[model samples]
Target: MNNPTSGTPAPDGTAKPLQERCDNLMKRIDLLITIVDRGKGDKIVQALRDSRVTYNLSSVGYGASGLALVDMLGLTSTEKDIIISVVPEERASEILNILLYKFDLDKPDKGIAFILPISGVSGPIALKYISGLQQARP
Candidate 1:
């Protein structure tokens, strides 16, 4: 469960809901998660490392995302690392809850993120693992 992105210095920079209706003309996007916490966010990073179902791109949160004061936009998420992944429609909600609760995604400025539509995935095994993690829930 080692996270390769762990300890990696982020540029110090930089979603939506699982449901809530998206635009019919807009393209479906992948699930992108940006985790963060004030003081030290390494623990959350380690937690993601331990239970990650999928790992895409992870980088340090900074810049505008860090300058964010409210949680509506991802600007407030720059305090930590951003993890992006692609998950199926059915599995998106579960992943959201995990980040929101399992990872406390709703901690306001603590660091919040959202998921969008995913067109496709390059790694099916990785997708399966992520879906498996969602299914193995409490």
Candidate 2:
């Protein structure tokens, strides 16, 4: 029997180890995730660009507050935009500030943003695309 589920085969029949496969997904990167009202994704993306955070992606999604809120609104779900961006650690704070102050996220229901720390980074192509590596300055 060919144990296809065991691992991912590169080219030949041999399966790549799980650790090796996971390594490809790791990157010394931090992710900034923002959830905003529908049609507000552009604002988040613009802020990232303004902060020089070049690598980012935005998508539409639905937000569920809770059963009570859902009942109060008489709606099933609230439309929202989810923006994900891979940023360097040093720049995360500044980008977040722009999204908060400039975009008025501090106000209620304006939306929220947070940063998730990444442990390890791999994949040459992704690294190149993100360009997250920082050159030491004197």
Candidate 3:
């Protein structure tokens, strides 16, 4: 049998498969989801756009505060806007920091943001969208 990975053994002393090596060569992608008070999605999206982020989405939701005090204060069902953005892992931290300061997310009730590591992506369109490489392709 022939090994396409050049017999390079991963740290565990076992040769990694060709497919894994190919995947590792590709850029890593991540998803950033931010939940903010209603009417704030535009700000986040605009900031991302200004930073050259090409792909992002937003949806409406309601915050379910389970605290009795919140209920008494009529804060149980607060309108929320969920914004989701996909970017390469290399730029995820910088983008997150921009969001944090731009939206005052560090303050209480301001909003919340998280980054999820993507295992794999399929299709050239999706890859282009996430990788922000939409140049001419044959």
Clashing pairs in 3: none
- For each candidate in turn, the TM-score is 0.46, 0.67, 0.74
Candidate 2 lDDT over 47-113, as tens digits, reads 7887778888899898877588666877754899999998877678888888899889888778899
lDDT of 1 by residue, 1-138 (tens): 323333434344322222211211122335656556543345544544555444555666653543334545543434556666654556567656666776555665557767776655445335445444435434
Model 2 weakest 10-residue run by lDDT: 129-138
Ranking of predictions according to TM-score: 3, 2, 1
Would you list the C-alpha lDDT of every candidate in the order shown? 0.50, 0.73, 0.79
8-74: candidate 3 lDDT, tens digit per residue:
5665776667676544446578999999989989988999888777788999998875587877899
Off by over 4 Å in 3: 1-25, 135-138
Indicate whether candidate 2 or candidate 3 has the larger TM-score: 3
Where is model 2 more than 4 Å wrong at Cα?
A: 1-28, 66-72, 75-77, 132-138
Alpha-carbon shift of residue 39 in model 3 (angstroms): 0.6
Model 2 lDDT, full chain set = 0.73
RMSD of each: 16.1, 9.8, 8.0
- Candidate 2: clashing pairs of residues: 26-121, 26-122, 27-120, 27-121, 28-121
